[model samples]
Target: MSRLVQRITASIRFTPACVFPLLIGGSAIAVFLAVFLLPVYAKNNSLDRAIQDRREALERQELFAPIHARLTMQLREASSLVVGDRQDIQDTPKSPEEAVYKLSLLAEQAHRLGLLGVTPHPDSLSTQDNLAAELRLAGPFPQLRDLLITLLAQPWLHRLERLEISGGADVEEFRVGVSVRMDEGS
Candidate 1:
C-alpha cells in the first residue's frame, strides 16, 4: 500500500504546470455556465410569464364582449345622426357666439343619446377640426356608477380624459370632457 501511494504522489508532483491547467479548465466551465446557461433559463421563465399574462387578458376581453357589443350598437345609432350635421356646422362657425350656439346644439343631440348634462365649452377648440366639450349631470349614485361602467364598455376609440365627482354639489354629477375628431379629407 505504501509503494502504491508513493507512485500516485510521484505522478502528480504538485507542480505549477499541472495545477495551472486544472485551474484554467475549471474557471472556463464556471464562466460558461454563468454566462450562457443562466440567461437561457431566465429567458424561458420570462416567456412563460408573458404567455400567462396574455391568456388572462384574452379571458377578460371575452367576459366583456356582450356589454361591449350593446354599447357599440348604441354609439353607431347616435353617431350616424351627428356625423353629417357636424360637417355643415364646422366651416360656418367663425365667431365665438356662433361656436357656442353650435356647441349647444351638439350637446342637445348628445343628451338624446343617453348622455346627460352635456356642455360644450367654447374655449375647447383645437387647431384640428376636433370638437371638444364638457358634460355635467346629477343623478342617483347607482345610475352614475352604471354610466361609468357602460362608458368603460364603449368600443369607440374615444377616451374619458377627466372626471370629477363631489358630494356637496346640488346634483351628484360627474363631469367629463368629450372630443371627436373630423378626418381632414372628409
Candidate 2:
C-alpha cells in the first residue's frame, strides 16, 4: 500500500480528456440551466405573489360584505319609498291640519302594527308645495316591518331618509326620518 501510494503520487501527468469535459461541458450545462430555469423560477414566484394578493382582496371583501349588503338594502328602501299607493286623494295638502289628519291615519295604522306609542314631531311640519310631517316610532322589527308595509300602502309621497333600529333579539327601537306628501304627483 505504501509503495502504491508513492507510485500514484509520483505519476502526476495531467490528462485533458476528463478535465476538459468537466470544465467545458459542466459550465455549458450550468449556463443553459441559468438561462432557461431562472426566468421560470422568477415567473412562478410572481404568480405566487399575485395569488396571495388576490386571496387578501377576497378576504377584505368578505369582511365588508355584510355592511355593503345593509347599505344597499337601505338605499333600495329609500328608492322604493318614493312610490305612492293607489289612493285617489287630492294632488296636495293645502293646510297643516290636512297633513296631520293624513299622518293620524298613519298613526292608526301603526297602532294596529303592535306599537303602543306613536309621536309626531309637530316642529317637523314644513310647508313646500304640500305639508310634510315627521313621525318618530319605537318598536320591534316585526312592528317596524308592519309599519313600513302600511306606510307603503298609504297613497302618500314619502322620502324615507333615515331608519335606524338597534337592540338584541327580543326588543328593538326605531329611529326613522320620513317626509310625507299628499300624493306622488305633488
Candidate 3:
C-alpha cells in the first residue's frame, strides 16, 4: 500500500491536460450552483422573511386581544340594556278608552306627586290614527319636573308634542301635550 501510494503521487503531475480538466470541472460545478441552487436559496430566504412578517403581525393582533374582548363585553351589556328598555315600552293600550284611563291614572299620579288641578283633555283624541291629549297641571318646578319624568317613563310609545310653561319661578303652570301611538309591527 505504501509503495502504491508513492507510485500514485509520483505519477500525478501539474501538466496542462490535468490542470485543464480540473478547471473545467470546477467551473461547471460553479455554473450549476449559480444557475439552479442560487435561485432556490433566494426563494427560501424570501419565504422565511414572509413567515417572519406574518408572525410579527399575529403578535400585534394578540396585543389588542384584551381591548377587543372588553369592547365586545361592553357592546353585549349595551345591547341587553336596550332590550330591557324595549320590553318596558312594549305595554300598549288596547282601545281609546283604555288609553284615556291610563292617562287619567297618570294624572292622578301627578296629583299625588304634589301637583294641583291635574286635568287631562282627551276630547280631541282620535283612535283612527293615533291617540293624543293635553294635560294641564299646576305645581312647583320640582314637581313638574318629576311629573314630566314620570310621563316619559311610562311603558308605551309616548311622544311629547307640545309643552308650555308659565308662571313665577316657584309655582309654575304646565300645559304639556303628548301623543301616543301603538307599534304596528309588534
Q: Give all TM-scores, in the order shown.
A: 0.42, 0.39, 0.42
Write the residue-wise lDDT of candidate 1 on 110-148 in tens digits. Answer: 332234555555655544445566667555555555444
> What lDDT, from 0 to 1, does candidate 1 have?
0.57
- Candidate 3, residue 130: Cα displacement in angstroms equals 1.3
Evaluated against the true structure, the overall lDDT of model 3 is 0.66
Worst 10 residues of 2 by lDDT: 82-91
What is the per-residue lDDT of model 2 for residues 1-186, given as tens digits with 9 covering 90 to 100? 999999998897668875887799899999999999999999999999999999999999999999977975665566355434434233345455666665556655554333334344566555444444555555557666756655644445455656767767776666665566654233
Find the 10 residues in a row with the least total lDDT in model 1.
149-158
lDDT of each: 0.57, 0.61, 0.66
Count clashing residue pairs per candidate: 0, 0, 0
Off by over 4 Å in 2: 1-14, 86-186
Better of 2 and 3 by lDDT: 3
Model 3 pairs in collision: none
TM-score of 2: 0.39
